[model samples]
Target: MEKYSTNAINADAPVMLATERLLLRQWQRRDLGPFADMNADPEVMRHFPAPLDTQQSNDLAARLCQLIARDGWGFWAVETRSHAEFIGFVGLRETKPDMPFGSCIEIGWRLAQAHWGKGYATEAARRALSFGFEVLALEEIVSFTALPNLRSQAVMQKLGMHRAPDDFDHPAVPQGHALRRHCLYRLARGAWQEQQP
Candidate 1:
């Protein structure tokens, strides 16, 4: 594994991991503007209910930072190694208890629309999965998305995660919300190890 860096806001915060082309690092002030812009973009937020306003975007970023500070890991702020630009986030986060796959760690990613189709999500997520299995010693990591989010599901498949039989409605979303219905995917630690050389 490549050595990870910790050029975070402070010593308390640390860069979580690195991939060949990306760094999964602690959130920085420089990330806020692009993050808010990405959250506000309609096309980027299309799979969700609606785009986030500036405050909501800031709140979400704050929460992600807090989670990482508390647990030493969460959805990490991702940057391109070449330009050191903050594109978005990709890492592991604790799944909400109300969800069908209760109390599990999940791997997820969201990048600016301009950064899509470059295989960044898959590359970063593979690093996150390694952290989960190798460092955290987790048995499995799960991922889920609204049924229509085939693009995200494709990433899960590429990472060797298999869909589970049960699909559930996301409790946080309204009961009848079009995006409430979600598909679950899981990757066992053994399965992840098998994929390695």
Candidate 2:
């Protein structure tokens, strides 16, 4: 999936956004270790099919980096302002056309196990949503996770995304896999603006 050329505000520059406590910036080489460690943690990977090995994690990171480099925005690496510690990643990405919701940009996050419950996901997501609407002028953004991933659902709710009525089987997950079923949440630009101060 690719970002639209007509919508991106930073099409030629490296992407970076800041929150009160976090910095959402381009992924760095130093981020791979922490990123892989986070991916390897079973507790953190519990919602997915399985934990990613080091090579898988590094490969994923490289793709994310390339997307940001190409489109000027993707799932940016999130770090702290005070500590500059790489907690994880949070940002927007384009979903494949075949995804349950069809082609659209979606918000996503993955944080280190140690960083759970710190409001980092919500804070960084809020900024990402703002960029999606204000900067990219997107019409909508959606998020989804396995049916059992209520933690991620909570973050979606925090961002004012309403649960879609139907559940769908994620094609990417193998048939009969426990994580195959997913719930979707969406927020439209008009609704998002109404929710803002």
Candidate 3:
């Protein structure tokens, strides 16, 4: 028997998620400056090819907003509840269709280096996953990262996603790049349910 029904993708929800210390919401103009700075941080962009310039970071943030405006949900802007500061993004992105696993939606995050050890990624991600598996009623949500990105991989494991056996080369990464090879992790709705209290 199929473990989960196919009724996924709720038209609403995921617009905004508020956790104990964070809020995930649509992008705002105030977020751009800090976002650009964060993207420019070499340590923050360590797994990627290089840090983003201001123009590139702004363009990327704009694109994320456009996606949210169209789909009602995406890698929403993350901020702190106490200070109400723009941190970074944490949510989902739909991968390309031709990949080995086919087109899949993945949960991901990026925050300022200052916020690294506070469990912000994990906390915000839990809300995102709740939005994905519960609000959207998705069958599965996957997360992937460069082979050396142990920090992101750690978040995925904390979310209870299992590491899949078949690792794949990322199409976006240039050939022979150290980060081209990626690790995949997945979480099924049925499995997420088992994790519930």
Which candidate's lDDT is highest? 2
Candidates in order: C-alpha RMSD to true structure: 4.7, 1.8, 2.9
Residue 165 lDDT in candidate 1: 97
User: lDDT per model, in order?
Assistant: 0.88, 0.93, 0.89
User: Model 3, which residues run further than 4 Å from truth?
Assistant: 1-14
Work out how many backbone clashes candidate 2 has: 0
Error of 3 at 19 (Å): 0.3
Among residues 3 or more apart in sequence or in different chains, the pairs in candidate 2 whose N, CA or C atoms overlap within 3 Å are none
Displacement of the residue 17 alpha carbon in candidate 3, Å: 0.5
Clashing pairs in 3: none
lDDT of 2 at 55: 100
Please identify which of the two predictions, 1 or 3, would achieve the higher lDDT against the true structure: 3
Residue lDDT tens for model 3, 38-127: 999999999998899999999999999988876778899999999999989999878788677888789999999999999999999999
lDDT of 2 by residue, 1-197 (tens): 34444454556787799999999999999999999999999999999999999999999999999999888899999999999999999999999999967888999999998999989999999999998988888888999999999999999999999999999999899999999999999999999999999
Pairs clashing in candidate 1?
none
Model 2: lDDT equals 0.93
Candidate 3: residue 122 Cα off by (Å): 0.4
**How big is the RMSD of model 2?**
1.8
